[model samples]
Each structure stands twice: as structure tokens, then as C-alpha cells.
Target: MDAYKKAGVDINAGYKLVDDIKNLSNNKDLGSFGGLFPLSLGAYKNPVLVSGTDGVGTKLLIAIKANLHKTIGIDLVAMCVNDVLAQGAKPLFFLDYLGVGHLDNEKAKDILAGVVEGVSQAQAKLVGGETAEMPDMYTHGHYDLAGFAVGIADQAKLLSKANPREGDVLLGLASNGLHSNGFSLVRDILFKQNTYSLNDRLAGCNRDLKDELLRPTKIYVKSVLPLVEQGTVASIAHITGGGLPENVTRILPDNLSAVFDYGSWQVPAIMKDLQKIGHLSFDDLLHTFNLGLGMVLAVHSGDADEVQSQLQAAGEIVSRVGRLTSGDKQVIIRKDQQ
Candidate 1:
């Protein structure tokens, strides 16, 4: 054993892990200095590259605490690919970075498998990734994951804040659960403050607490990409850390605001449980968590019905949650009159 191995950095094990990744992802060029992707501008007259990067957030803690590593990688890919999808791009390739205190080949393989699944779900290729073994940087049996996704879209057809206009209807896609946000608060409330265990089943929830917390984020690429291509979508918002109010406002023009008809869609029971346990206010819930809707779209009023129909046909649970109105660039959640 050399001095470097003695210091906890195993060069040979890293090389073996590279082979493991190549087998898991089937990317032969993964061990190279940089990942390679063959880009073909099939239908894009003027192709524009859209890129996004994100991490799984403190949600990793839940996975680690439960010793569940399979689905976290999906969250990693969803966090990035969904962002690019929000910009009306088709995800082309993905890359991941995993940092760990010690290299455990089995655990690493499980995590990479989820990444592979995520890429498959997004219809993107996993070109390459890096696994860093840093002693003392992270605790043993714990790792951090970050992912980068690159997508392509026609320069003229790219969705932006300017794309949304007044009278456009806002369509919200239902989220499965927490979908990888507000975990810092979730952890504080469920574990630090309350006595809930991952094994305990909360009211209205079908699965155990661990299953709810670790539910992988839903990838919107497959369902929303078709709408983007059809040009029915004016703008899309991938609700994440800032929840609906913060994320929806990002794609709203300065003179337009999003008026959401709250209670239009079913709020996942897990979210309600957390709110009650934490005594969270509506505003707090709005600012921190996704609150059920994962991705919201601003569609032209004329095409709202057709778009909703198409989303339903694609097996997406969507709601006519809001509309764009003449106001400052903000989100207004109001009770539904009808």
C-alpha cells in the first residue's frame, strides 16, 4: 500500500469504479478527460444549447439516513434536466459528480444505477461523470451528488419570461410528493422537533414516511416536451426550492402576474401532514416547498383545453390552476370561486 492509499484515496479502486460506471451506463468513453456527445440538429433550423446544473439538496440526508441510495440519483438528474426542460429544450446529455469520504463500490454502483434510470427517463445520454474520494470531506457512508444537463432548442422557439403574456392560462402538473425540496425544514420538523419515524405512516399517506420522503422527483421532459414542440406552451416553470410563488414569477413578464386558483388541484397528503406538524403558514408553504404542483405552464387561452387534453392523454395529472393577468411580476394564490 502506497502513502496515498494509506491516506484513504485509493487509485486502484477509483479505476475499478470507472469500469463499473462504464458497465452500468454503457458509455465507453466515460473514463476519458471529457464526455463526448454526437450533436445532430435534426429539426432545429437554428439550434441553441440550453444548460442547467443542480444538486439533490438536503433530501440526500433522508436517503442516507434510511440507507436508501437507489433513487437519489434520479433526483439529481431530475433537478437538472427539469430545469432545461423548463426553458423549452430537449435534454441531450447528462453528467454527474459524486463526492464521498470513502469509496464503496456497491453503494456507488447503486447510486449510478439511479442516474442511469434518470437519464433513460429523460431520454438523455449519460456521457460521463466523476466520483471523488476525499478523506474527511464527507462522513463515511454519506455522499453528495450534483448533476449537469445540456439540452438543445430552436433559438426562435425557446421559452422565456417574455413569452408569457396577459390572459395566458396557467396549467400545473401534479407532483408525486415533496419532490426534493424543503427537506431542511422537513427534517427539522419531522426528526428534530417531532417524534415521527420513517416507519410511521402519516394519515392519508399510503406508504411509510421513508417512502414518501424518498419518492423520486417526477421528470417532466417526456410529458412537457411534446407540448413544447407543439408550441402550445408559452412558458414553463419547474417548481423547486422557491416553490410556486418564486419559480412561477421567474418566467412572468414584469407587467404580468400569475393568479393561481388554489384548491383547484389535490394537495398531496404528505405536504399537508408536514404543514400541520410544523404549523406552517400558507405563505411559508408557498415559499419553501412545491406544495404538490411540480411544473406549471403558461399556455395561450385558446389552446388551454387542447393542451390539457394532450397532457391527460400523456398520463399526466394536470390542472387549470391559474392564469396570467396584468400586474407586477408576482404570483397570487387565491381561492377558486368555481
Candidate 2:
């Protein structure tokens, strides 16, 4: 009713937008009736379907505030796709769910554009999605996004934490910026320092703070997938909501631990700002944010150099951040010597 719009949900617009993408989402792998994958499975002795679902968290607030909605859809897709890839799966298809308090056609279109863009980048299909217009649930012009990604990998090829051993190298892939995690703390620091305006230009980055903040989470699907073919990759950790310490530890086997020499790589300027302003301790920063490294690759010690060279040649910012050590499952962060 009219009151629904007044309350912030525009149900009619939501219906039309969903109809708009239906034609564009025709995937041969996806069935007319159900989620589909009807291909010859002659290659794998055993094929395992891997799936992951994720949403861009409160970081959507930053995008919404900056009026930059396109890339967050990229973040949504990347978040889900990248996670499945961590398990050594090849992303085959993706589906999204959008919930908006009120619907605006232009805004919905922009968001879908991003999803399409991300799917294209990841070489995955946008099979289908859901858009909900729930008036009372969100404020006007505010919406949230979540995505589901399905990938496939041979059961024997799946990266397992069962054998992450001591002396293995931790190769880190660089992040563009914050990459969809640690925004809450970052926002707090910026606001407390009175630096929340997206329009304001950052001093050294030569871009608006909003531009830097809302940068989409990097999709590691392209860069790391090839390595899976080599069978040298032991495990991977997609550093997300719980920063390096927690995330890296997640994929590490019980007999293994990470010994990070924090000085090994340069922390990006944006994170440096937070560290300086918040006076947050080392552990807090490492456990709460990616800092600079976005994805960590746990590779066999013999394959470390080759992997690093391959990644760098691919124009990826890769570094040997640390090594696995013989210890209880723990993340050891060593301070840079001043």
C-alpha cells in the first residue's frame, strides 16, 4: 500500500527489477526447474560440489553513504566465490539475494551491474537471485546483499587442513585496501578522528576516503586456481571478518601454527592510519583486520619460490609472510625491529 512506501519499501519496483534480470540469467548449467549442472563427469575419479554463501557486512553502509553501490555487489560475489576457492573449488555459478527497505529501479540496476561484473571477473555464471522489498525492515534507500556461490572440485583435489605441516611457507596475496572486513573498527577510528567524509581526499592515496574504503574485496579465483592444477598448494586461508590471526588459523592443521614476521611486508597506508590513530595494539590489529595481506596461501616449502614467482608474474602482490612452525595451533606475530 501507500503506507508501505511511506514506511520505506516499494514492493512494485522490486517485482519489476527481479523480472528484468530473469532473461539475462539463462545459464545452460542451471536448469529451468532447479539448480543445474548436467555435464560429463569423466575427468574426476570423484567430484565434490563445494558451496559457500556470504554477504557484505556493515561495509554496505559505507557504500550506501558514499552512493557507491556498484562495487559492493562485486564484494558480495567475491566474498562467496573466494571462500569456495579457498577449498580448491572452481566457482561454477552464483546466486544473489537482495533485501531492500525501499526499492529504487536505478539503484537496483546499479547493484545488478556489479554482480554481473563480478561474475564475469570470476568466470562464473549468475544463474538466479531473489530481491525482497521489506518496508519496515530497512531505512529508506538502504538495502543489504548476500550471495551464494557453488563450485566444483575433485574430492582428491580439495585442499585440506589435515596435513599443514611445520616448515611450510605462508605466502600472502596483497589486498587493494580493507577488502570487506574490519570496517566497523575502521569506521570507528575514522569517525573518532573526524575523517569520515567520503568526499574528502586522502592525503597520500590521491583518492577520496570513501573510494578507498568501499573498494571491493579482491576475488582470488583467477590468480590461485591454476596452482590447484599443480597439486602443490597445501591449504589456503581467506582472511575475512576475523583478520589474519583467526582466519589463517582456521585452515591450519592442529599440529601446525603460523609464525608471522610482521616486518616482512609493508602494511598499506590506510591500515597505518588506523594503527596510528586508534593506538590499537598489535594483536588487536592483526586479529581484527587484514592489514594488507588479503589471502594467505599455505604452500609446501619446496614450492614456495615457484608459487611466489608465478603469482608476481600474474601481477599479483604476493609475499612470503611467514612459515608454519611445530607448535600448538596458534598465530605468532613478531614485531618489526625499529
Candidate 3:
């Protein structure tokens, strides 16, 4: 074996992962210096390319602790693709980066499987990815995941905050669970302070904590893209690391802020459990986590009901959670004064 192989960097094994990815993604031509995607797939006179990148965050620690590696890639893909989707882009291709101390075959396969599945779900191509086995860089049997996604949208169709009016309604799409954020706090509360194991089933949760924690981030591309294409959406926000306040403010006009009714939607049980355990205030929860809303849209008031019904028919659990108002604060909380 070579010196690098002796240091746990296996060229052959990594190539094996490449082969698996090729077969899994059906992209035989993927090992170039840069990935190539044709711009002629459809017709758009003034095309604007959009791209985004993100990682799975500390949620990977929970997955690794639980020995549940398959679904983390889904979270990786969701974190990346959904961001690009927020700007009314149709994601075209995806790539992933996996850094590990040692490459275990079954574990690598499981991770790649989730990536392939996520790409299929987003209707995008898995154009390329990398799996690096660094001996001392990461702890033994531990790895981290990051992903990149590129999308395309027309100039006129690009959604922005400037277009949202004062009367626009904020429609919130429900999150599956904790979609890969606030995990450092989650781990601190659950493991460090509360002494709860990943195997420990909470009082209200049907499954164990690990299952709830490892629940994959929902990809909103398929759900929100149609609404974007219809020209009904003024702005879209993907609820990620910064939660509602920060993420929603990204797409809010200076003259218009969003007013949310906490009572208009139900916070997920897992989140409530986290709040009670950590003694985290409601403001803390809103800024730190999704609080059950994954993707929110600012749309015309007249089209709110139709958008909700159509999104429901398209298999999305959506709620009319808020509205745009004249304010300097980007997001104002009514706190059950609905």
C-alpha cells in the first residue's frame, strides 16, 4: 500500500464510492474538473442562474451517535437546494462533499443512497461529489456532510422582497421536525444537562429522541416551485439556521414587515418538548428554530385561499400564518393575539 493509504486515505476505495455514485445517479460522465449542465434544456430568453451551498450541521452528530447515516444526506441536499428554490429557481444539479476519518463501505453507501434519493426527489441531477478519507482530520468513524446546488430562473420571474405589498399574506409550509438547526442547544439540553440518551423515548413522542432528531429536512422545491411559476408569490423564505425572524427578514421590504400569529399554527411536539426541557423562551425558539414552519411565502391576499388549497392538493401541509404590515421591524410577533 502507498504512504497515503497507510494513513487511511484509500484511493481505490474512494474510486469505488465514485463508481457507486455514478451507477446510483446514472451520471456516467461526472469526474471532470467542473460539472457541465446545458442551458438549453428549456426556453427562457433572460435566464438567471442561482446557486446555494449548505451543510447538515450538528445534526450529523446525532445521526452518527444513533448509527443512522443514511438520511443525513437528505438533510444536506434540503439545506442547499431549498435555499436556491427560495429565489424562484428550478434546481438543475447537485454535488456533495464528504469528509471522514476512515471510509467504511456500508456507511459510505448509506450516505450516498440518501444523496441519490434526495436528488431524485428534487428532480435535479447529481452531477458530482467527493468522498475524502482523512486519517487524523476527523475522529474515527465520524464524518461531516456538505452540499452544493445550482438552479435556473428567468429574470422577470425572480422573486424578491421589493415586490411584496403591505397586504400580502404569509403562508407557512409545515416542517417535518427539527430540520437540521439548533442542534448544538438540543444536544446540550438532551445529553449534557438533561441526561437523555438518543434511545430514550420522551413522554409525548411516539418514537425515540434519535428518530425525532434524525428526521430529514423537508425539501420544498417541488412544493413551492409551482407557486413560484404561477407568479403569485412575491417572496419566499426557507426556514433554516436563523429560524423565522432572521430568515423571513431576508425577503422583507424596508417599508413592510411580517406580522405572525403564534396561535394560527401549531408548534410541533418535539419543539415544545425541547422548549420545556431547555427553558427556552418563545422568542428564542422563533429565532433559533423553525417552530414547525419550514418554508413561508408572501403572496397577494386575494390569492391566499387558492394558493393554500392548491398547495394542499400538491401534498404540502401549509398554514396561513402571517401577513405583511407597515413597520420598521422585519418581523413582528402578535403572540396569540390572533
Candidate 4:
């Protein structure tokens, strides 16, 4: 027999994946090889293409530990889409890559279904993807997923860190608790505490720990794209592996830094539990976990309240977290002081 057959990777599963995704793969319209998007020049004076690619980090280990394979696909899509959105681009299409030790049809299907769900939520087309079953690696019952997303925006319409000025306000949209980042530290906490199962519910949290952990990364595309379309936001930051302090600064101009009043928003209960139980310090908690806020938008001070109102009406928990200041590169998190 073939090497794949000898190595436990079923060649039949590869055929089945393509066959099952025929409808999805055939939705291409423009010049993408595996996936396509129609060029609609209806709205742009001069359009520019923005693309981002990202993978769900070690968070896959948690999903594998909990035997929860489906929702991680959403994380894969969200990671890439959110990054592009930070550049004021609306996601038009998404593609994925799934790699594993061996092909498991049921698990692969579950993952793809979640990816489709994420694409639908982001209002983007699910184009195509690569699924590789590499035997003798990754150990059984484990896999990794990543995704790429492409978006279009007018060259002049795209946002830049230059928009952030001395008086711009920082508005934070609450996260759904540790969404697809900081899992390495989280796993460390669990291992250090000797807790093997993620399903064990925390002391005061409303949901099982595994359920909370598996909560799909939020797709802020639809919610924030309208604001970008209206030309209201100055800059946007997607909080990923690095917590607020680091991620927020990436989108700030060289002359501006963020001065965050960390007490402005309430920290979610799960983070509180992690801090108290795991004996994590304030610095670690702020630098490692989302602490409830996911995405932050920098806008003119005059528009801050209005933008917050609009985002709130759209069902996003918007908070006035801080302000842009004239300084060198650094993010300052402090309480109001005398």
C-alpha cells in the first residue's frame, strides 16, 4: 500500500473533504486561485486590498484537552479577520488551514462547520482551505488551525495611527473572556495548579471552565465596519496574544501613546478567579489576559461619546477607557491620581 495508508492517514478522507466543500469552493468570482471574490468597484475612488493571516495559538491544546474541536475554527477566522479590521478593512472572504497527525473526517467536518459559522457571522464568504493529515507528528487527538482573510478599502479611506492625536479618546469593547489569546499562560496556570480537566467549573463563574474557554473569538467585523464606513474612527486595535498595553500601542503613531485608566471598566469574573486562585499578580493579569476588553478604538475626543453610544446601540459594551497623549512609544495604565 501507499505510505499514507501505512502511516494511518486515510487518503479517502482527503477526497471526502474536497467533495464535501464543493459548494463552498465553487463560490469564487474574481482572481483567487482557490477562492474568489468579485471586484465591486461601485463604492471606491481608489480601492486597496488588505490581507491578514493568523493562527489560533496554543489554545488548540486546550480544545484538544477538552475534546472540543468545533469552535476553535471560529478562533482561527476571528484572529485573521480582526487584524485586517484594525486597518479599517471589512473582511470579504476567509480561507483556512488545518493540519493534524491523522485525518478524522468527523472532526474535520465539525471544524469546517464552525469556520462557516464564523464566516457567516463576519458577513464574509467561506472560500477554500487546506487540510493535511501528516502522520507521525502532532500525536493523535491533536490538530492545529489557522486562517487568512482578505478585505478591501479605499486607499484614502483606510485608517492609520496618524489619526490618533493628543485628545483622541480610547473606547474599549468588552471581550467574551480570554478569546483565543493568552492560552499559554492559562495552560501554565492549570498545569501549575494541577488541574487536568477544563470542564471543572470555577468557584464563582456562571459557566463551566471548559465552556467559557471554548467560547468562540468574537467577530467584530459587522459591528465595527459600519463605523469605519461612516468615517468616524481614527484607529483601531485588535487585542490578541498581547494584552491591552502592548496591542493597543501598535496602532498608535510615533508621537502618541495611550494613557489608560484601567479602573474605568469592570474586569470579568473569570479573570478575577484566575488572579485570586492562581495567585497571579496585577502585572501578569494585565499583560497576559484580556481582562474583559477585546477591541479598542481611538477617535477624536469630540466623537468619543457619540461613538460609544453608537457602539452600545449595536450591542457592544463600549467603555471610555483612556486617551491618546503626546509622548514617546509606551502605554501607560494607571488609576486617576492627584
Candidate 5:
């Protein structure tokens, strides 16, 4: 061991991680100080590269508190890839950055495994990444994850912002419970204010709080990418920190608004339970959490049924949640079910 190893850095463990990631990504040449991806411009006639980078917010605290390191990486990957997918891009490759106070070989590998799994799930290659071991930077057993994804879309095939029009139908894709957004509030309400334990179980929830909260953010790549490629989707919204109101409004043109039937689709029991326990207003719930929908899309009225059929065939729970109406940019949630 060298002086670096004596000073809390394990050189061999770093090398072991590099080797493991290299094997996982199948980029044997990644050890060359920088990662490389070979793209044949010949494959695309005028391509636009789309890039996105995102981190799993304080939701990471739940994973750390519960000592569950496996799925945060998946959330990390989903956060990035899904954003890129919104623009109709096919993810080509992904890279990750992990920073830690001290290197624990087994734990590090366990965490990275989810990244590898996420990349695979996105049908993208994990081309490169960096794992930094800094003793003073992070506290013991503390780490942070950031992911970057690069993808390509043909210029003519992009999911442009202007595509949505009045009379278009909005499709709501089901979310797997709190998919890595507003978790700081979630922790504050459940764990801090309410004093709930990780093992605590609430009504209408089949799993413990830890299991429910740590459920990985869903990756929409495999489900929605096909629609993007086929040009069946007019626009898309990846529901994250802004929830449905903020995210859905982003893709809408100024002349249009989305009007949703509140009771058209079932809000996940966990989210409803959170609302009841926290006494969160409907506005807060719409803007702070996904409720039950993860990705909402705009499809032409005629194409809506076919798109829903295709999405369902691709194994997604699809709901025609709303429609585009002529108005200033807004989201209207009818009060019938609230």
C-alpha cells in the first residue's frame, strides 16, 4: 500500500472498482484516463445530440438511513435518462460520478450494481464513470450519486414543444410511488414531524416505510422510446420535482392548457395516505409529488387510442388522464374526486 492508502484511501479498492465497472460496461478500454464512445454519423442523417445530468435528491437520505445502497443508483440513472427521453432521444450511453468519505469495497460495488442495472434497463451502455474517495469531504457511510446521459434524435423526429395542440389527449403513465422527488418534504413530514420509523407501516400500504420510500424511480425509456421512435407521441413530460402541474405545463404551448379529470385514474394509495397524514393541500400534492403518474404525454385525439394500446402492449399501465383545451398555459384538476 502507498501513502495514499495509509491516509484512508484504498488504491487497490479503487482499482477493483475500476475493473468491476469496466467489466460491467464492457468498455475494456475505459482505463485510458477518459472514456470513449464510437458513433457512426453515417447511421443518422442529421442527428442532434441531447444530454441531461441529474442527481437523486435528498431521497438518498432514506437509502442511507436505511442502509439500502442498491437502488439509489437506479434512481440516479432514471433521473437523467428520462429527461433525455422526453425530447425523443434514444439513450446511447451513460456515465456516473460517485463521491464517498471512505471506500468500502463491497458496499461500493453493491451501489454501482444498480447503475449497471439501470444502464441495462435503459438499453444504453455504461461507458465511463468516476468514484472519488475523499475522507474529509463526506461523513462516514455517506456518498452522493450523479449521472449523465447522452442520446441522439434525428432532427425531424424530435418530440418538439410545438407538437401539442388543443383537443389532444393526455396519457398518464403510472408511477411506482414517490419516484425520487419531494423526498425532503416526505422525510420532514413522515420521519421528522410525524415521527414514523422506517419499519412503520401505514394504512393502504403493503410495505414498510423504508421499502415504500426507497422504491426506485421508474425508467420510461423501454416503454416510451418505442413510441418516440414511431412518432406516436406528440409531447412528453417527466414528472419530477415539479410534480404534474410544473412538468406538464413545461411541454404545453402558451395557447393551450391541460384539463384533467381528477377521478379518471386512481391515485396510488401511498400518495393518498401521505396527503392524509401530512394534511397537504391539493395544490401542494399536485406540485410537490407525482401522485401516481410519472410520465404524462400529449397525443392527438385520433392517435390517442392507438398510442394507449401500444403503450399497454409494451407493459405500461396507461391512463388517458386529461385533454388539451384552448387557454393560457395551465393545469386544471377537476374537483369531482378531491
Candidate 6:
């Protein structure tokens, strides 16, 4: 045996996995030092390259524990692509990084299959990625995933340049359960403190607890990009880590505040179950999980109905959640009225 293989880093295994990844993603250039992408500038006179990178977070722990490896890569791609999409960009290509202690070919292939599915969902190509097998760096069966997505947008149509004004209507797109955030708390509440197994089903949830927990994050590219091109969407927020309050407030101007009509959109049952069982406060829930809305858009009141119509026509569940108001920079969840 080679000294390196004896020491735990198997070069042949890494080489074989690379070939398998290339085959899985159907990209022959994946094993190259750098991923190649051809830029076609004909689409926009003033094109801007938008890039975003994110990881699957501790959600991977759950995936590993549940032995569900196929869809976690979707969460990885969604996390990065949606952020770029929030800026009104069209995803062009994606790259992923995997770090593992040992290179298990089947497990690696399963992960890559999900990445391919995610790239397909985003309408992006999997150009390149890295898989590092470092013995002792990770547990024998555990690996981590991170993804980077590059997109293109006309400079004139960037969502960040859209100035959100007071009275602008807030439109929310439905989420697919807890989409890759607040899983640390979820694991603690469900497995640590409560000792619930992955097979255990909580009240109001139809599937086993594993299914709910491992649901891939929703990708919002196809639904929102058309609105962005039409200039109907003023600003967009990808609700992730900090939930609605923090993510929405990022796109808001200093003089305006976002006031959401709480209950206007139905919060997912899984979120409510976590709150009830975990004894989590509404404020905590607001700051942690998405609570159903994955992406929020700020549009002019006149364009609100049309934008909602367009998003619905694109097969998204839309809601007129709330509107911007003249106030300090903050998010206000009003339960009194819709």
C-alpha cells in the first residue's frame, strides 16, 4: 500500500471519485483545475456578474443521522442560487465543495446526484467543484458541503438598486418547511432534549419527522426572474438565516419599515409544532425559522396585483403579506389585521 493510503488519504480513491463526479454531473471539465464558463454578453448591454456562496449548515448532521444524502445538495445549491436570484440575476453556473475524512464513492455519487438535480432546477450548469479527503479532519462517515453560484443580470435591472418606498406592498412566496436554517435548535429540541427518533412523527405533520426535516429548500429563480425583468419587483429578500425580520430589513431603506400582516399567510404546521413543543416564543420563531415565507418582494401598490398574478401564474403560492410604512428601519408583525 502507498504510504499516503496507509496514512488514510487515498489518492486513487480521490481520482476515481473525480471521474465519477464528472460522469454524475455530465460535465467533462469538472476534474480540471478551474471550471470554464463562456460569457455571452449579447443578452445585456450592461451586464453584472452576481455570485453567492452558502453551506448546508448543521442540517447536514440531520441528513447524515437520517441516512438521507440525496437531497442535501439541493439545499446547498438553493442557498446560493436564491441569494443571487434575489439580486435579479439569472444563474449561469454552480460549483460545490465537499470535505470528507474518507472518500466513500457511493455516498459521494449520491451527493453529486442531488447537486445535478439542484443545478437543473436552477437552470444552471455544474461547471466545477472540489472534493477533499482529509483523514482526521472529519468523522469517518461525515462530510460537509458548500456551494457557489454565479449569475448574470443587466445592471439596470438589479434588485438592489430598486428603492423600496413606503406603502409598497410586500408579497411573500411560500416556503418548503424549515429550509436549511435553525436546524441546530431543531436538533436540540427534537433529539437532545426530547429524545425523539427520526421515525417519530409530530402532530400536524403528515410525514415521518425525517421527511419534514430533510425537505429541500425551495428555489425561487424561475418565479421571480420574470418579474425582475419586467421591472415590477422593486426589491427582493431571500428569507434565510435571520428569518423574515433580518433578511427583509436588509433591502429596506432607512426611512421605511416592513409591517407584515401576521396570519395573512398560513405558517407551516412543522414550524408551529416546533414552537409548541419547544416552547419557543413568537419573537424567537420570527428570528429563527422562515415560518413559511421563503422569499419576500417589495413592489409598488399599483404593481402588487399584477406581480402577484404573475408569480401565481409561475406556479408559486403568493400572498399579499403586508406593506412598507413610514417608520424606523425594522420589521413589525401586526396580528390585528390582514
TM-score of every model versus the real structure? 0.98, 0.92, 0.97, 0.93, 0.96, 0.97
Residue 256 lDDT, candidate 5, scale 0-100: 96
- In candidate 1, what residue range of length 10 has the lowest lDDT sum? 329-338
- How many steric clashes between backbone atoms does each model show? 0, 0, 0, 0, 0, 0
Tens-digit per-residue lDDT, 45-126, candidate 6: 8999999999989999999999889999999999999999998899999999999999888888889889999999999999
Write the residue-wise lDDT of candidate 2 on 176-247 in tens digits.
Answer: 788888887877887765655777755556578888888888998888899977887899999898798889
Off by over 4 Å in 2: 1-12, 22-35, 192-195
Please report the candidate that would top lDDT against the real structure.
1
Error of 5 at 293 (Å): 0.7
lDDT assessment of candidate 4:
0.84
Error of 1 at 127 (Å): 0.5
lDDT for model 3, please: 0.88
Q: Between candidates 2 and 5, which one is better according to TM-score?
A: 5
Determine the backbone clash count of candidate 6.
0
lDDT, candidate 1, 1-338, per-residue tens: 69999999998998998998898888889899999988897798999999999999999999988989999999999999999999999999999999999998888888999999999999999999999999998984778999999999999899978788899999999997999999999999999999888999999899999998999999989989998998999999999998998899899888999998888988899888888999999888889989899999999999999999999998899999989999998788896553
Error of model 2, residue 276, in angstroms: 1.8
For candidate 3, give the lDDT of residue 42.
67
Per-residue alpha-carbon lDDT of model 4 for 1-338, expressed as tens digits? 48859768787778777676654434533223556567898998889889999988988888887887888888888888988899998889898888988888878888887888788888998777888888777795888888999999998889986677898899999998889888887787776666646768887678888898888889898889999998899999999876988898798888988988878987888788878877998888988888888899998988888888999888999888889889886888885631
* The 10-residue segment with the lowest total lDDT in model 3: 34-43
Q: Which stretches of candidate 5 lie over 4 Å from their true place?
A: none
Candidate 5 per-residue C-alpha lDDT over 113-184 given as tens digits, one digit per residue, 9 for 90 to 100:
899899999999888888999998999578899999999999988888789989999999999899999998
RMSD of each: 1.2, 2.6, 1.2, 2.4, 1.4, 1.2
Clashing pairs in 5: none
lDDT of 3 by residue, 156-199 (tens): 88887668998899999999899989999899989998889998
Ten-residue segment with the worst summed lDDT in candidate 4?
23-32
